[model samples]
Target: MTEFRAFHNTDPPQLLKLWHAAGLGRGAAECLSIDAFEVLIFSQPYFDPNGLIVAVEDGEAVGFVLAGFGPNEEESALDYSIGIICAVIVHPNFRRRGIGRELVLRAEEYLKSKGAMNITAGPSGLLSPYLVGLYGGTRPSGFLLSDPLAAPFFESIGYDATRSIRIYQRDLLGPKPPIKFHLVNLRRKMQLMISDDYQAPNWWWLTRLGRLETLHFELVPKTGEGAVASATVIGLDLYIPKWEERVIGLTDVFVKENERSKGYGQSLLLEIARRLQDELITKLEWHVEESNTVASHVALAVGYYQIDTGIVYQLVSR
Candidate 1:
């Protein structure tokens, strides 16, 4: 018989095992450890013990659900009144026993108790409190889309894919096609500058966890035209299960609204790539969201082809 109970801090080892079995906690040789979990997730301001509902069978943990809400001030931005189901994983050995569904049901109830009128399965849209840490990004593929079990499982519970994102992977293991950019001209005209160890505009949750070393580039105006564009390469890939040498995830390039269309964003991207290539980073990945047409175009131009697409599922409370 399977027993359901609230998760405790001591359950990290079991949960980490479950994450590995479920094909999660990637980018590492080992799954999240107790200390890692505390730094990556439990340290969040919105983390609630009740949010982690686990299932135990014969004293061995089998499955669990993690849910949470955004900060009060950011409710409007994230549909805070509507809770988020960050993750739901069941061990493969214990599959097809309704364990997954039960975990979600309990997660919804926990969110309802928090005054949520509706619930979203994951990052359906915008920045969310879901899938942080090793899976961190303002917008990433939904946890469900990455897992074969997640799609059908969520549908069975009335959750549907409200949004889908295209995940592009580039093979840096081979020689990269050379690309041209007017970087020198831009630097003189727009005062574009590149600096080491760049950080992005702070987001509360991001500041607390999951930040890796990255490069920062920005446009400083010479004519006092104000900021033109700013981008940062955030986070490293293949850090877990051992580290991938000379590689990093290419993310978060922002060109000011008025400054867009001059190829600033793309210029920044290629420049970052060139800098990395010089340092022997042969593998680079550029992730593009469905709505980010500019970045999407850049990904393709830079020889990145479609490898995987991720969908964000949502369930409105009934």
Candidate 2:
């Protein structure tokens, strides 16, 4: 017999045990500490005890599901209309017992009770409300296909795949990819500005990335006052033990609307890669929507290769 209940303050130890027993993939932080959970999940201002459902049998946690809401269009506050089932983990020993399904059902009930009209499983982009760096590389990128269980489990539960996320990685120890002759001139014309003191542009940005040690890179034309492109990255020093390499997760890549098709994005990425290489960073990880051809091009132009993919699932209407 199994009992289900909301998370208790004392459940972290049991939950941590269940996490390792569940066999998550490389995208997940394997060496996560209780403090990591506190900073990444429990410490968030919007965290709700009721949003995390825990399954217990023999007075020990066996499985769990975490649910939360994304920010509104303005990124100012939670939009109850949209609810996200961020993660579902069931202990390996408890497999084939329907514990995972029950956990998700309980998560759904919690979301629906909070006025959610549209529900999504597997957090991605701004839809992500928890476990950003802890689960996915750099940012919340749905559920990685490397997990094997994610797609089948979610699809079997009536969630349809709506978006594809491509994870890319570049080894910075090797020589940087060569740039075009035109790009060389462009590089000379633009300044690559790197800074450690980046102020978040908005409340949502602050909420998501505030805790990480962020590095901001901007490409600006020598003659202009505005940046043509910019990118944000955070060091994954905590992952060094698990990955056995120094890593940085790249996110919030952007280019000015008027700067599109002018090679600014590609040049910015190459410069960023070069800088990371010079600093002895071993690897850089980035993810983008599969439909984003421009970003895909930029990443490939800088010698990044697809290392994995993730699927974003949405709950189908009855």
lDDT at position 314, candidate 2: 92
lDDT of each: 0.66, 0.88
**Model 2, stretches more than 4 Å misplaced?**
none
After best superposition, candidate 1 residue 209: deviation in angstroms? Answer: 5.6
Which segments of candidate 1 are over 4 A away from where they belong? 25-31, 71-79, 124-126, 136-139, 144-146, 173-205, 208-211, 220-226, 237-246
Q: Write the per-residue lDDT of candidate 1 for residues 1-318, one digit (tens) a residue.
A: 988899887888888788777765332224346666666667766677898999999888899998876544543233457688878889988889889989989889898887887677764334456454355232345753445566777887898777767766566666565645565567566665677744434464354323445666776677887567776565454243344454456555678888777767666665566666776665565556688787788777666776556667778445
The C-alpha TM-scores of every prediction are: 0.84, 0.97
lDDT tens per residue, model 2, 53-120: 99999999999999999899899889998999999999888887899999998898999999999899
Clashing pairs in 1: 27-240, 28-240, 28-241, 29-240, 29-241
Worst 10 residues of 1 by lDDT: 24-33
